[model samples]
Target: MTPSPILDLAGLTLEVNHLGRGVRFYSQVLGLELRRHDEAAGVAEFTVNPHQTLTLWQPITRQANDERLAPLRPRGASHLHYAWQIDPAQLEPSKALLDAHGLEWQEINLGTDDRPDPTLYFFDPFGHGLELRGVNRDDARQPHFPPTPVQRPAHALPVMGLREVALAFGDYAAMKERLPRAYGFAYAKEQEDRDFAQFTLGPQAEPDGNGTPRRWLYAWDPQVGLADMLGGDHALVRFYADVDAVAGQVDAAGLLSVRDEQGLAVRDPEGHVFEFVPA
Candidate 1:
């Protein structure tokens, strides 16, 4: 059977070591609002956009044997890194907030091929690397590239949209094949030898209605070192959408959960780590 078309890029979920601590850090530093929490489920969710949510699941005692909660001794897995975009005007205020909270951050000027391109880097309380990009008004207001149809929701508000995601795989080809099989991602394009590929997912209808599909880019760079750089395997990006739907796909893919509670850090048949989230 054909897979259901992806509604849009959803948000990502993480399994944090301490749910309360993570919630405090993200809310204060990122200005996120807590949308939902279930102590019984050991889950807490934060909203970055209307449809996007960042979920934090605490380790359940019953599932302690899962590798996601394995003791960090020798060769333990690392936390995931995330990138967020913010308006240029909010950069200083946001940075100030972090400083007042005694949070250490690294200001980075990313040199891009385009004009007005710079990004700042910082770590969360848990030492997860994060990038804050200043959106170029010209670029943000400019028409979308490839000019695909877009349908605006009724109640529009500021939210973080998913841009792209990077995947690291020991075997690239196998991971590529499983994506289309599990998710409704169509083969869009591929870069030779660079081990990079792009996939498109969306509703089959036009932009005016509720059936618009989303786009995703999957990248694999074996040469890139995560340990010496950001201290993670790869990054998973999700756009604005429902959290449950995104999680559904992750479950369908049968990828192994990287975390003990909420997040899955499953490697596909090709040995690529796929980070699934709500868009």
Candidate 2:
């Protein structure tokens, strides 16, 4: 049980083709508070929680080709599969938020009586497959960090924060090896000789447990049987860690990664990008 330098699931950057429509859906529909926006860069930041952020970036071809951004080329993919954390009490109400806005959604149970993984699934205006993963807690426990009060719009879903980011790629084999060897992620769960895997960087996998907060990165191939992938699969997942350490491992593992004025970044075999910055 050694300590993990990968501090937290820092943020997620999504490919928001239209900045205004994407921002409106997340703000008015999901209730994420707007934190920062650089119109010139076509980027908008929303406060998901004290430790996590959800960013919407409209790819600026000219800006990305600029001398400064070209090296990193920071961008996100469309139709990425990701999840948001919410309490069980707020689960049913979340469906209402989707229906009230004329958005179609589905609810599913991935667990049994002993461990019920209740989830609400839906899509944003831009078609990113979003899931409201429930935090099923039977007893009260101390949280890893103090809760921050964020003022959200009335139409917002009762989302706690970014819970899980699931990426589907063809090169699951390479990513399965790359995630742990380079980033210190340990296996949480995996199926029999399967293409899907779960890796946990923090103590517990959710707010239900006591230690540090948990952030999830799920890697799976298309054959994993997703109802709908929304015609694309990939993500830009960020983490706060020792950049030197991440860079060191990237070299040791012989991973093709980018290091610039920002920090260390890498695109995986299936196009999902991982960015490592200073803690």
Candidate 3:
């Protein structure tokens, strides 16, 4: 079956070591607007924009009272990374802002057979990687190449608008069923058993005759020796924004992490790992 066009990229929730410190870093350095806060509940939400919102909450605990809210030391490797897409034009200004803040960054051309433009990469205050790309409105309207004649995909949507991402979960099957029921993501196909399952987070239906169905989710295979293949351990988180504005803001924060062809790495205040890549 054809997949639907994604409704929108939602915010992410992560366990933090220090809720206040993490919130401060995300709000101040990332320029995310605080939308809501529940001190009594020890939960807060930040809006990246109208469509995306991030929430920071204390780790799950059984203790009663304020003591439960106390931040705890991170227990695992901070190898996760998240990528946010921004407008291409804002790249230099954003980079300058990061420089003003004393943050370091590295650049690379993300040219591919399908796309040959430059994509800038950097990190957040914590060390999550972010990437910015320039995608014109017209460019987003072009039909998916290796085109399907019967299906005329929506022309209004823009490319690089949070196309898709992978979310790591302990119970893959549970999430596989729960996400679609709660969020509207439809099961597309399994990339490789439970390790990685692809889902259609969008509403754009694949043409009836399309050769292979379009997939949204790419589940990770824990069994695979990913660390060994890369020579080190790594993790990922993915975020989406107006391709035009994200880079400049990231650069302005001056907390960008640098890296080689792979891209820079950064962590959230609580130490969750992530890497930024352009959509």
Candidate 4:
């Protein structure tokens, strides 16, 4: 069998309706450095992790041309959910920052059999779900990747690295089986429920000394009233991977669904769109 490609979780690109508001919240409120802002192109880039980045692009209606070689289809404001990792000690200070800015947030406890890591969930100005999770050094549920160097704005708690990304799915078995077969993600942890189930994915390693592996979630039977965030017009999550290689395997597995200028787009059994673009 052809093994899944050595897929490295690069970063994410967000298509936001309000570029100015999104940029301000991510840079000033989230404390990430604004790497670049191109008013003419209507796009902005922010360095979220050392190797990972988050690109914010204005609504397609205003786009004359974009730096990205390919035109992103079905692109507009995104209702995406992504998480960032933070040192445990930085949690209180993070609260202080959010409180000072008057940003509202709620807590989530993703408990495992052993223990639970503290998590704070909030939304960006455009209602994209964002999370700050306390890094648990002892938790096996997390991945250990090399620390990404972030330029911390003065007086703001340091944002460490990308933690986890959650994707909602209707056909759990296909996503569970196909992702590992196509990407080099090894199944790590799982929680099963008749109505809700979760699977974690990452590169298998013996503590590479980097820190933790980037974590991803494939969730099935999403909670009621959250379908918009899962599989709506603006619902999408993109990953940086070797598109050609992935396409090759997808063809081999008879899973190749769509090929476009943007990259190889595949629809999971549940009809969720996942794009793999050139790294």
TM-score of each: 0.59, 0.83, 0.50, 0.73
Give the Cα lDDT of each candidate: 0.49, 0.69, 0.42, 0.59
- Higher-ranked by TM-score: 1 or 2: 2
RMSD of 3: 15.1
lDDT of 4: 0.59
**Per-model tally of clashing residue pairs:** 20, 0, 41, 11
Residue-by-residue lDDT tens digits, candidate 2, 1-279: 644446556788888788988888888888887897777878898888777788887878667612443454445767777877667677788788889999888877777777666777777878788887665333333233323335566788877777667777676677677777776665667668767787664533333222123556677876534447432455677877767777877788776678887777876656666887765
Report lDDT (Cα) of residue 3, candidate 1: 32
**Looking at model 4, which ten-residue stretch has the lowest summed lDDT?**
205-214
- 164: Cα error in model 3, Å: 4.8
Q: Taking the tens digit of each residue's C-alpha lDDT, what string does model 4 give over 36-146?
A: 887767778887765566778776554533434233343432556767777767777788788877888776555554665556777777767777776655555444344
What are the candidates' C-alpha RMSDs? 8.9, 3.6, 15.1, 5.0
Which of the two, 1 or 2, has more lDDT? 2
